[model samples]
Target: MTAPLRPLVRIEGDTLVVPGLVSAHSHAFQRALRGTTQRAAQTGTFWSWRDAMYRLADTLTPETIADISRRAFEELRASGVTAVGEFHYVHHQADGTPYADRTALADAVIGAALDAGLRITLLRTAYARAGAGRGPEGTQRRFSDGSVDDVLRDLDTLRTRWKHHPRVRIGVAPHSVRAVPASWITALHADAKAHAMPLHMHVAEVQGEVDACLAEHQRRPVELLAELGVLDARFVAVHATVLASHEARMLGEARAFVCVCPTTERDLGDGLPDLTALRDAGARLCTGVDSHVLSDPIEEARALEMHERLRLRRRVTFTPDRGRTPAEQLLVDASVHGALACGWDVVNGDRETSWRPSTRINLRARSLADVSRDDALDGLFYSGSAACVSGVDDAAE
Candidate 1:
């Protein structure tokens, strides 16, 4: 019997074709907070920094949201990100009122992603209370959808609107254990499972969150979710920065994904994640540009390896037993694993179609000029920057 034909391969000009980077987590509106929130006195801690973000969140209207999202998504595409998982929570109008359409803000964000020529997974977030046992106050009003039924209704509308659009999809995000009760998470998880959607949430990003969860539930954040039966392959825990060893093992055993946003973690003083522990527990890793602190996927990938090196005081600490180099592994985290976390079928679907949103790197860029074809991936991650991203396919939109 004849072997099946492989897709014809081609190399054109000085370009290298690779899987496009998937931004597994992003808060696109926070892109506007970059220069303005850098004052030392205002952002000494994560809570303080959050205050600054809240201020910005209050000022966004549907128009401003679309503009900000378009600009941020454009920047992401230019930096080699072909798909984005937008963890959007700013849902209601100011003063905690729903817009006439209910999904007005969500529509703006999705339109922006389409206009900017990128695939989008809008992880419409459910932000109920301000925190555990606290009421929605001040700017928190904008993020709350009132009830789980309200959130599910809005999600149904969004799903119907984008059901036929290939470049757009929907997912569920219970903001965090801090923002919602355990009941809300279980309900959202059930809805997510029924619809076969991806479920993401912030988990153990900082010590304060862990402390709050422990005080309220007698368990760490991941432990609570695990007990609720929310730990599974379709679940993605964004910013699993402060996980205990056993929690890491639980996530790995459940085959869940942990998305680390390194630059934002550094900016917010969130401690580096226990990379070795998570890997040893068999957890797959992915990266994101959470707060738009930076939009470079290559830098995010490099930072993951560099942070591990700094923690362990050794070079190339993330090398896997499968014999792939650390650079290769990091790239996979940025691209393939990221796509998986965004609910893209990267493993079993047609490469060209499933990975509709793809990016191309310029081998002729100044940073990569001296590198040979054999060392292209290494050179791109180590020495190259987003400036090395030449063109992204328009098919993603």
Candidate 2:
């Protein structure tokens, strides 16, 4: 006799089957900065904290980067993040020289993520300058490829090497408006489009960056990016906290994704984003644990909602779009949209591929014990923590 079919939605023990969380932006090596840079007197501002980060960057070698990145990816896995868009920028040997392999540091980072059992989208970043007219100095030396052609060459090599990798994908980043000029942005965007790769950039993360972009480009960061033809559905604007209403509309019209790192933004004293403006303007939202200040995806989602409530002085600041509830909306931001930001395709099926990593939650945890199926997501986003994620499974792509 044939056996009866099992229910697809059955409660398997105490686990909650949900889509895996995605970290849309990350600097895995910066995980080391957690306890070291939190001191009050030293980290007076983001610029001050960056000095400490540069010092740490100067100390990394392939071996050390591998070790630290492995631990960081492991933490992300334990916190229910099955996929990450690692904004890897540290390149070259100390003293501004390229390694023999050219992509050695990037290879180490990808190896670590694979070792930690997480899907990785290595956002190969280009750093051509320290600022508009200034050359790279100190730790910044390690990040530069000297010119846009060099950056494209490295990306081509990386893509060819990982062309068959199931859990590893490649994208391009221009670092930031300060780190690259208009010509570089235009060229990189063209390259990304030619390859059909996702593109990301740090846009208006702080007031100083905005002022710099305005002074150097005669326009704000987003405005300059739009003018340069860099805004699009595949573009992700990281930490867009200082955007103007018109800028929000521009991003929305392009259907670009805005990846907000709430915890890290708060830690660095970056102002909160205008969520209402962005939503009304038609932009999609995603979350990231940038800087690894907090590795929990649930906490990141909660912080996004809390920050909105605080800013608007009202409850339920973010409403559901396309028939989802507020809690569901937040979860989608943490998972589905995040995958999209990282260039992952979310499909509905049991089949697993590097482009389709999945994550499940623990329904048996004390925090979720009394939650009904309908209310489970609400409990997780509103009152739960990463500690409630008891198990994480990764499928080889």
Candidate 3:
């Protein structure tokens, strides 16, 4: 698990320049729920936290959502994130009605990211129901679509509107098995294929979701997607925390991307997925800032290894897979894999296009103050924070 680290990280003057990071699965609006969900409350369940999320979702207007999203995107930019996959689902008014301009909310989010100097992939989501035989009630109505055509129409509108914008990409997401039915998932997958778009979905995030999915579909979430022929290289499964080893095998066999949000998944009491199994079988890994619970991409990347260590109760769990050191693989998970999951090409850290920005780590920062040249990357990765990001390469657009 050791190699010369020049290709992944390079020391230049007092900074370590590297590839820009990508937060592949984000709900920009959930940034508002950061510390609020941490306090000791009576309802400590994930469902209860989700209810709190619904309340916040109900309160957002185009202007307010724009302001909040802008703030979140700015924070991500400062944290060395060049691109984001915003899994935006709030589509209609609070009362389950469409606005005069149907794409108003989506436009607001995109504008916020652009204003914050970030390359954004607005993963427009298709949500239909609360559960099996249950209509979309409460704040979910705002996320619901009457038909797959309606969802695709809004996506088409978004694509046309942002078509020529260099920093913008439009992708389709079927929210989850709970919020969306089987038919919609198939249609959304097909639509993404037709457009050659990045396809992301909330897979087995929590135990309750897996249980409900099993009861409804007689299969796990990944199993259901496989059964429907939706598992492929273009698919990105978000928060695949609760899964069988065979499920990981399915995703790996397809060379699909698993976008893990360790910070957010741990925050919500979601268990860890067998990342070793996934990697061994063939799936690529990526990182996300799902809840903005914390905004450190380094911490996010490092936690994949740390959490695995905790789960397996062993040190240096998996051997390097692709001639990369453990630190280098984690950096790829934090940067290159994320961009690729968002359907962007990445060769190395030097590229600085609208969506392909470079990142620089401050070698002089306290986190790596006395580190030797040989171990600068290891120290920066394992011990550094977003505060170590040099100001010159902070934001990207």
lDDT of each: 0.87, 0.87, 0.87
- Number of backbone collisions per candidate: 0, 1, 0
For residues 224-287, write the lDDT of model 3, one tens digit per residue: 9999999998899998888899999999999899999999888888888889998898888999
- Tens-digit lDDT track for model 2 on 92-175? 988989999999999999999999988899999999888888999888999997789989999999999998998888999999
- Runs of candidate 1 with Cα error greater than 4 angstroms are 1-12, 347-354, 394-397
Candidate 2: list runs displaced more than 4 Å. Answer: 1-13, 348-355
- Runs in model 3 lying further than 4 Å from the true structure: 1-6, 348-355, 392-397
Candidate 3, residue 354: the lDDT equals: 23
How far off is residue 316 in model 3, in Å?
1.0
Model 3 TM-score relative to the real fold = 0.95
- lDDT (Cα, tens digit) per residue for candidate 1, span 89-138: 99888899999999999999999998988889999999888777788999
Best by lDDT: 1
Judge candidate 1 against the unseen true structure and give its global Cα lDDT, from 0 to 1: 0.87
